[model samples]
Target chain A: DAGITQSPRYKITETGRQVTLMCHQTWSHSYMFWYRQDLGHGLRLIYYSAAADITDKGEVPDGYVVSRSKTENFPLTLESATRSQTSVYFCASRVGGSSYEQYFGPGTRLTVT
Target chain B: AQSVAQPEDQVNVAEGNPLTVKCTYSVSGNPYLFWYVQYPNRGLQFLLKYITGDNLVKGSYGFEAEFNKSQTSFHLKKPSALVSDSALYFCAVRDAGNAGNMLTFGGGTRLMVKP
Candidate 1:
């Protein structure tokens, strides 16, 4: 009921297809982020939003798109999924007061074949 | 650019023994450091943080970290290792003045505590 929640915990998509991973937070945190986790890479941010209409790219933003129309939701879209995009994706949020301590969602494991 | 480094890819310790996982950082201003633990199939869990004040900050699961400004390191330590302590640990740093709380994380160190 509270905290962050990620939808479609497991997803399988064909290469070139579009897929979107959803993230929702109940805390109403001002800062929300999306990251992809892979072996050896740990976690790298893909995109982050400071507010509903303000968003920016992170370390790995290529081929991915993100939008935050409301504070509670931040969605990550893969316009044309590739095999390299097959990895676990996580959503996180932190209040503007202390953006340092982020709360992470369980994650969405996406597979592109 | 600010970044963090965890020297060891993995650390093995016998149960009941003290354990440590090393981390180092580079930043332009005062650093806000943090440690997070992640189990398989789970998101990273917040461990401890060193913002200001004291160098030694204690966290959940009997874990603590010592910040050494001179050494530019923040190493995680536990008094006695437990088998269940096995997990992936990450060290992160943020430039307190301008980083806006977005943490730059270390690659991560996996801990294996054996009985």
Candidate 2:
């Protein structure tokens, strides 16, 4: 399909373990974003990439790393997961120019125990 | 910097009654506002957006939002509430000048519709 998709829709890992969430979009959108959704926080941006090799930090980027090696792929990695890091992660993409709305993926639910 | 606020944590409305979810935002440049609904265990779905032309924007599922620039509010509304309309609603804002495609989301409002 020509939509955004996230890998490992559900994941569980122990604290201090490293894990990665993969995001791929078939539309070849120039802008890809990673956001974490918590209980009280609707959605906080973790990282975003304007284009391949051009990434920037968002509101809550600490403890998370992201890279966009290809236009269709943007991966987020947690070096050492913590309980606080466990949340629903969403991947979104948007094409540049006149449109500003973003299309979101199904989301990945991560649990750190 | 851009920020969005959804004042009501939860809203209760009866089926066939009108419902409203409030949202306010602050941004440095021209504002691009959007509303999204998230069903349980699903990602956010884009509802409607207010870009430039009209102040009153109609969205999916018969939802509409009126953008009041002076008041800095984009409140979502529906003529008659439906049971299926109950979901977590979020309001997000992005500054038009922001080249990074960053959006600030509100805390979200849980809408409950009773039959």
Candidate 3:
């Protein structure tokens, strides 16, 4: 209840369909990040927000979209899901700055068929 | 460009034996290195970090890491491995001066401690 949480722990979506994964953190951290964990690639950052309304693309951001309208919420949306996008997505939050450690949510397992 | 490399895909150690998981990094500037562990179907848990100061950094669950700046390596080590310590280990790095503060993660190494 006091840590980060992700909705729809497991999801299945058809190719070309739009899907969104929600992440919420109760810690009121200033930094939120979205990462996709895939076989052989480890965890690659997709998006990160320094604060509300401030966001930037990470390594693999082409197929993903993210928004942070509120400090506690940072949702990732896939405009058109692809089979390649099927992976476990994780949401993380940090208090402030690059030196701080991040806390991760359970993760959302998304399968694109 | 900043990046992390975990050379070993898997590590096997007997219970009560010392363990080491290798990790090396490359960055344009000074790096902030970190180690995290992940159990089945769970999120990554912070292990330890090497920011500045002492080369040996102690972290959670009796895990420790030694930072060798010259070698650009930060290897995770633990004495007396336990069966419960078997999990996926990740190494990450961030540029100290970068404003974005995004982290680059290694491919990960699966540690299996046999009893």
Candidate 4:
């Protein structure tokens, strides 16, 4: 509620189903990002928003969508879940200007069977 | 585009010994480097960063990083290790000249501190 939070810390879904992961931050930061973590790939950016209503694709944007209509919210959606999409999702935010650090959420573990 | 590399998959150190985690990066423009640590089930926690000035940067939990321009590396270091310091370490880089300022992270290195 204060820093950054991800809903449904753990979720189990089946392939072909639709799922959405919610992220909320109270810091009013202008930059928000979505990332997925895997074993050898580390963390790959899925999507990022510079401000409300301004979102862009990252290194790994396949099979994922993100929208940020409010400065405090950024949601990632999976139109059709797949086993390859199963991984931990992280939400992060950074202040505008010269700041270089991004604050991260606790993360959501999604499992697709 | 910016990219980062962490060469070691894992580093084992005994308690009270000095420790270091290596990181290298490539960026089209000036580099902004960072280090983050993650516990078993927790998200990444910022450790330190190097933007400009003083190549030596200090950060949370008794951690420090040195930015080497010539080598294009920013390595994390600590004077002594602790059992509680074991975690996954990641290195990230950003291009200061890039407007987006998006950070690219390394594959990560596991630091195992043994007693």
What is candidate 4's TM-score for chain A? 0.98
Off by over 4 Å in 2: none
lDDT of 4 by residue, A1-113 (tens): 57999998999999999999999999999999999999989999999999999999998999998999999999999999999999999999999889989999999999999
What lDDT tens digits, residue by residue, belong to model 2 across residues A1-113?
75999999999999999999999999989999999999987899999998999999988999999988899999999999999998999999999887888999999999999
Off by over 4 Å in 4: none
Question: What is each candidate's DockQ, to 2 decimals?
Answer: 0.73, 0.86, 0.89, 0.87
Query: Comparing 1 and 3 by TM-score, which wins?
Result: 3
TM-score of each: 0.97, 0.96, 0.97, 0.98
> What are the lDDT scores of the predictions, listed in order?
0.92, 0.94, 0.94, 0.94
- Taken in order, the candidates have interface RMSDs of 0.9, 0.7, 0.6, 0.6
Per TM-score, what order, best first? 4, 3, 1, 2
Question: What would the per-residue lDDT of candidate 1 be over residues B1-115, giving only the tens digit for each residue?
Answer: 7899999999999999999999999998999999999998888889989999899999999999999999999999999999999999999888977645467889999999999
- Name the better of 1 and 3 by DockQ: 3
Instruction: Evaluate model 3 with DockQ and give the value.
Output: 0.89
| Number of the candidate with higher TM-score, 2 or 3 | 3
Q: With candidate 1 superimposed using the best TM-score fit, by how many Å does residue A5's alpha carbon deviate from the native?
A: 0.9
Residues A1-113, model 1: lDDT tens digits: 67999998999999999999999999988999998888888789899999999999888999999999999999999999999999999999988875478889999999999
